[model samples]
Target: MPNLLSRGLFNLFFGSKRKAFEKLPGPTPGVLGTLGDFIGPNPWDVCARYGREYGGVTLIWMGPSPGLVLNDPAVIEEILLTRRLEFEKGNIGTQIRPTVGDTVFIANQGEDWSAKIKVEPMAQPWAAAWLAALVGPLQAAINESVDALLKEPSIDLTPTLRRLTFDGFAVAAIGEKTPDSVFEDFMLLAKGADARLQAKLPLRFVSFPEGFEAAKERFYGYFTERVRRARAALNPSAVDLMSWTLREMPTVSDAWLGHILGTLFYGGVFSTSTTLVGAFHQLQKYPAAEERLAAEAATLAGAPLTFEWLRGAPWSEAVAYEVLRILPAVRIFLRTPAADTELAGVKLPAGSTLMVSNQHLHRDPSHWKDPETFEPSRWLNGGTARDPAGSGYFFPFGRGPRECVGAPFALLFLQTALATIAARVKVHVDSTEPFEEGFFFGVVLPKGVTGRLIARPSQAASLPGSVHPSAAVKTA
Candidate 1:
């Protein structure tokens, strides 16, 4: 309640000050891109328009607040790096507070975030640590799903990928096998809540299960109990997050452990799944790109790709990058001004919202040579400068102090899972209608896609050493 009031007050007081923040001089558009396109097909169109009108840094209003949307790579770098400390997770953080609680999303600022930052389990951990052992389990899970795919000539690989991701990360992160029934249903509710939360819309009329909150509480209860058990059983050589966090922050309690475990599990499952589905949709939309990926797959190393091998495939990486750039899992990333601050020279009153959309950023021709063209080679070749602004401008894993912790795992999942499947079978995507794109359940997906692809064995040249026929190395 106080949060709502404070947010509303922020807009009321500083609405006019944000004039310089936007490229267009007027009110902002909705999901659609134009003045009348609020309810239009593509809301991110505004992002492109704004990028053209505004320079690198611009501001726009959405959902009753003003957010500074950045298009320039250099400014994104400054915001993500030099001046990162000045920002916070904004209303999107507030909306997700119900599920994430004091977890990092809402705690995107202050000493709490800084403290958590100290223990962030990111980057490529040592090769032999449990963190590194994760690639094996994730790959295995992807292989299993691919093998399962062979049974059906055409299956909606979206949920199939979702299930595999759930299992992959569960085994790697927490050492559990999520029951498909429970996990699938959980995916629905969790994703639904996330979409609304991400939208920063009012949830006054929403309905939920009687024990929804309690069930999550119980899950946390179980998570901490398991953490405690894992702590007690830890060997000096064991290198999982549980053991690592315990060794570092001996004062950490069950709630923190639970939050870490639960958040990782949730973030791990849906984001990867949606990305894979999105890529598949777009690849099918453009058959030539799909065939090109398959051609690269046919001659992949004779052995399946190891994490090392798969990670280096420029074409494969482009596929994943294009997927992220085009079909970003969520619509907008929002952050609050921790206090009064200046953004890219605009005087944003303290407490205003800040938003940047990948959908908008990805399509801007100013940065990308041909924003509308679906050529994976452009991304692979780096024909255009890496990015006009810098790294964070085109980021899907976000940037700086608040970037995603599960990024390595997510990429590992993508490269490994897609490689495993591509190695084993060919995707002959046939759709009844255009793959209806949306941020369905928050993670994103085709609205109603009924398509089937033929997965036939390919007897093409294989990359030696990196991947061998039937031998697999994967990620999730």
Candidate 2:
């Protein structure tokens, strides 16, 4: 029968993946071997638990394929920093290719070489400048959410915060304001895209929810027009990311522009929103940490949120770092050896898939004192800041040249957004329902968690200034 033929083919393909790294220990096998480990409802948590039980280096399954996961920091560092040149993006790149296209984030080492060279340099400096410039609009977006929460008896804060991040990033990155309908459609498409990628199926073969493709096309058209407008404009002071890309990277194509914009939006909605929600949940669980953060935030009650202010707030930064440490938005990162290599004494042939579990590495007992505890004070010693691109023990955004380009902006946004909200309101977790785990795309998010916001007594009014609207140019 056709079913038997399919099963035989699946086993044949999966068997080779298992044979490549057969020396490693992993989850207990079922009738179909490692296939059961990944076909469950919450694969990320299941894999993280396996990493904990099977020592730092374990072989796991991504559907039928075997993936080698590294939780040891030295091995992680070697693969991510020192021996980075010997690896490529691997399955993660393949998973995200349909959604992100072939830009720097998902581009293989030698394939999209030219586009990588031209586009990679623009992300970092522009991230730094963009963070400093967009505080007003960012704050305005945050304030709207905060104000709306003030009016609600009890509301789903996840969607509200997610929307604010998307709107803020749309203005900051794409140079246009996304209407609610468009934003909704885009998010739906993004979720569908993420589902397809996570399923590791060919996108063309999968059926998406209604309107997913249309929403995707609309965003493409929108970005294409923005590029055209930027080209036609003569303004030297334009501040959005599109203007910077057009001005500095003149030869970049409209397709590349759209890819970059799509990556930014995807990150803004998915990673940043999840991190903030988790931070808020932690604050609710630990009032002392919240009070300490608010006290630190109170120091700049009415001061305009600037890069300097964000950098200077030690407690705010600490809380953010602690949240990231405990509940990293990006749980797993992938790589494969570009050449035959040995990792932690095991020989890995070229093209062997390797996964780094941020969740396991972060909570590894060797890295911290009582790693499970939610103690923000641990990060505040001697004014050390947690880099999203790991220093040694942490890697929320990962490390090396291939680390997230949006990291600088993401950190600043977290500090500013957290401080901006904490300064004015005290958030209490609505504990009627217990916290549950959220599996979205491939990352973990806060589920069943809600908060009640109360005005902090004697707090100063919101910093004065309306958010600057979309313009060809604005003061940076």
The CA lDDT of each predicted structure is: 0.61, 0.70
**Residues 1-476, model 1: lDDT tens digits:** 12455545545655454445554343343322222433555545555556677655665554444556666666666666777778766565545556656665557665888777566554324423554556555666666666655556346667766777777766665665655554644554475466565453367655554556666666566568778887777655544556656665567776777678767766667778888877777776887877677766666534645656664666777777777776667655556677777766666667775556566667766556667666667775563257421255467777775677677667767766666666555554556245666554445555554444344334323211222223421210
Q: How many pairs of residues collide in model 1? A: 24
lDDT of 2 by residue, 79-166 (tens): 8888877788766665555555666777766557435755563454555675677676666667666776665555555766777678
lDDT of 1 at 217: 67
Predicted structure 1, TM vs. truth: 0.77
Model 2 segments beyond 4 Å from truth? 1-23, 27-30, 39-41, 61-66, 111-114, 121-127, 174-176, 200-204, 250-255, 337-341, 349-351, 383-388, 432-434, 459-476
